[model samples]
Target: MLVELVGQSGRDLDNVSANPARLVNVYAERTTEGERVLKSVLGMDRHTQLDGVFVRAMGRVDGVTYAVCGGHLWRINLHGSANDLGAVDTGRATLCGNNGYVCVQAGTRYFVYDPDADTITEPAAGAFSDIGSVEFFGNYTVITEAGGRRFQWSALADPTDLPGLNFSTADGKDDNLLRGLAMDGRLYLFKQESTELWYNTGEAGADAMARVAGGVWDIGLLSRDMLCQFEGGAFIVGSDNRAHLVSSGGFQPVSIPPVETAIKIDRPQACLTYSDEGHTFCAIIFKDSPAWVYDLSMNEWHERAEGVNLGPWNVAASCKIGKEWAVGRNNGEISILRRTNADGSTPLVREITSRTLRMDGQRTILREFEVFPRQGFSAGTMNLHISRDGGSTWTPPKPKPIGGQGEYGRRVLWRNLGQARAINAKLRWTEPRDICLSTQARIVT
Candidate 1:
């Protein structure tokens, strides 16, 4: 499950997890006061899906939690609730308000969006081919791709002109598949083709892998080196053709076992993600099915729970938040899992019922729907609510105006608000009095 977003464009995290939990813990940042708080949950419900193997995050726009999957040249932000924020469609990528463009693949292209007005524009950018992934670091956006080609986006360039990237990694040739990057503040690169893993010194044909483990091709980037999972060394491959950390750092080597028990591989490339508690998670293919969570501290591999299986996904994206993880499949299946127990054995998996109801690139066409009565509108006020789960429930939250002033409804701000899948509520205000209740129905997951 690829959870977090990758690439040079779109959104990333500002701070790392500060608090730790016995089973799992997460930090709650108070946007109103700008303070990040921490909390620990007893056990996760098996009914809720909270698994993410890619690099998605539990984000908040105006205190709303969202599930986002990002990769490729530029990261994508799925607005609204986790259930509704579908995968960032490749060709369906649209532009929204302020005429600001999303610089992907390290500034190779800029996809501009005007959400308020509902429009998407791709500014001609020559940076596309060379760009891999982009993300906003402190002041600049960091970009990387399968080759680990790193760069930054510059605003000085013409809006139509490609963003000037500031950095480069000549060592792009070091890793063949470019499995992992920047683990423990140091970039970890690996190419399954290599006989000896090499490290990148910013040059080609360098030692891209560390002597971390044997028969290793998968790598995950944790906050710092102190955090990360090792297969002690048992690893697995998922149906998505991605790799997972099935076991922890210390495991007795077992024979390849039977070809039936384990799956075969040609270029067995996989990815890993972390739980909100920083627990390492790996999803790999096993006997054709993509069985995941090989080594969750709860049960030792041999004695631990076998965990769940991910259906076929040509390209799967994942990310983690506390004990929860999310897996977004290309087939339009998003399985959210929570670590019910300390170990990965028992997990709470839930399929999202909500899908993309409507996506209008043109605003006038969207506003055409009169704000008046309809078949679904016999009650007081009906706010359109989206879910990360499979459209099972709906709750509209209070609307926070931009700049804290109740005047204008900024597009960028609403777009950002939509990122919080849990809190991003679509208000159905038949009367002004009903607006306050919107926040009361926010989904905390």
Candidate 2:
């Protein structure tokens, strides 16, 4: 957490308070790209791998943290340091590059994260479903329309225009489908059809993009069913069903499992890269399930996802990066993964403590007050009854300023000042609870 001091009304502070949020040191395994995610979650038992995200970080995922269990934007860091216009939890995240961008979903809200100076400012929402997949295709940033029908982001003409898909309109269907988009520096949208559409991020709408040639299926083993990129090019994943390949050349059928044997993959992302030592693969998280990594090089399947003393299914999955990676379950633990030497040998997963909520609503003044009716006043209503000046004059209570904070102690918010009597008053209160008052404390002013 960064610390700073502001002049109170233009004058220097007599002595700036030293109490501030702490930034614990942490580590995360370096991806093939050599990016180190914050792995502050050390020794936090386990809460089960339940939910994750991959977005540029702007740090500050504070505010009403969106990380509540079953919470959507729990670990979404599609931002940087600037307190986004609303509530975006991103800090110290690495996106592709200046041209490359990241997308995220916090609850029903979806936006992008730019890593320049720590700022988030897009408030694009109002969709049927949460944003599913976001990719920077050749010339545009293409995003799946989320749960329901969605027009292309281009429709809004925001600089972050998302590419349009051929599969669905604003009416989404069978879209449990995922999108693999990247710019060869050119516009490209890859779905199953193999007919790769070349799109322009520069253009305003879907009609602007044009489908280029079909070299995408030309290279090695690849199919629309699964596509993953390695050092050279992308490879279509080995399927539990009939297999096929997509390369720089075109499409070619390969040998593998039959279509009927295909199982609903809990892993939503495309496994792009992996390491032999730890047998861990890079894959995007889907349905909050553990990330799947096949040790093809070592003939093993390893799970680098987060887990805890809680139920494995507590959250759907835990294979994710960023701040919210380890936040979930009864223990409320958080964890980040780190590489041992390099080859990913049993990637070290550690827990990080959450920043204590340093500041809170002002300590309830927990004050008690007592009062009594002047010499002759009775029980019912009394006109001008009591006064600070020895009861020389009676002053009625001002109903407007009542109920603010801890007014005369009855936990002010709970006290019915309007129904109070014009007599003396007495009130008492405690912490973590409300205030109480007796007949003696019931007063008008």
Candidate 3:
């Protein structure tokens, strides 16, 4: 009899006893015939390395990409050449631009960059300080005061002009503002214990923006960096320890139980979103845990890690430069995703662990396990490890060659002579070759 090894969707729940299907560095894609198959994720290749220690944030303005790497602001051209614009603070930064000017809020200071003249200038000292987050809306730059209930806006068409009296307080709830987002013709003020939605009224000064009546939500934001705009809404890791999609309707939960459990354990430090191929992926990065990515197109979740130690996907910020998706790492490197199996020179290890199969305490006889991997790869091997005791321990790896070049009729089969009441299995590979698997795996008793 044939049993399903890989399913149509990825589900890695919190409770292993309930479900143990783990998809790492791979996702389920529906073919033209509506058959679900596993496909390896695109790898990252080095675009350029800056002279800074960490690439904190990235943004694009007027067809130019700018990044805050270490204490300097860089202008990255189309050919992966970085020109140091000037020096800025080194902490986490947020970049937004409008009217040919880019506004950067690094640490507690805000700087405005004009690509036309190649000049970086700090806003008037007393104009703003202690900025928690920044965004551009209605030709104005908006900012939230850290640890306070006030949000301010810049002069019309002038991001560097912030009038002293142009600020308003989001006091619908007695919570402090954590971030400010301008999206879909509205401005969202996220606080520690709630969120308020406001809209532009074309008024002057402090009355230019007004809160929508009955637009307050009980859901609070965890951090300013954990929020990203997706589709027509926004994706955020709420203070409730779960990921949510906040749209015009309200907050909707998007994280699974396993994802929630993982977030609850380590908590996300930052997040970024970018579109590749036909899918939009929001990657949530933690301090000490693997990164979890949400596929908005398929509504599924998967894992992404780098190197042999399987650390968090080393992505600090990401933005699309022209038609290419560019990611900035903490090590001052910028990379672009391509159709390969390695992250530059480092090999990307893909892994998947199957859910435990329990036979009601009835031992099954020896059988053969077979997998159907896409053939015609130049060279590679798929290693399978079996666990008879529900993944408590794994057997030695058994490697099988995928196929040679033009060899499209290869079968990855493993013959075994063992019996078990419960069976668990894992498959892993690390090669700079294309690898894909069908959703079916057969086991004959």
Which one is best on lDDT?
Answer: 3
lDDT of each: 0.29, 0.30, 0.82
lDDT of 1 by residue, 176-205 (tens): 332233323233333333211223233221
TM-score list, all predictions: 0.36, 0.37, 0.96
Rank order by TM-score, top first? 3, 2, 1
Model 3 TM-score on a 0 to 1 scale: 0.96
Candidate 3, position 264, lDDT: 81
Candidate 2 per-residue lDDT, tens place, 61-112, comes to 2222223222223333323111223344432111121152334443334565
Q: Where does candidate 1 stray beyond 4 Å?
A: 1-130, 135-138, 145-162, 165-167, 172-180, 186-263, 266-280, 285-287, 296-315, 320-323, 338-445
Scanning candidate 2 in windows of ten residues, the lowest lDDT window is: 3-12
- Residue 32: error of model 3 in Å? 2.6
Clash number for every model?
107, 61, 0
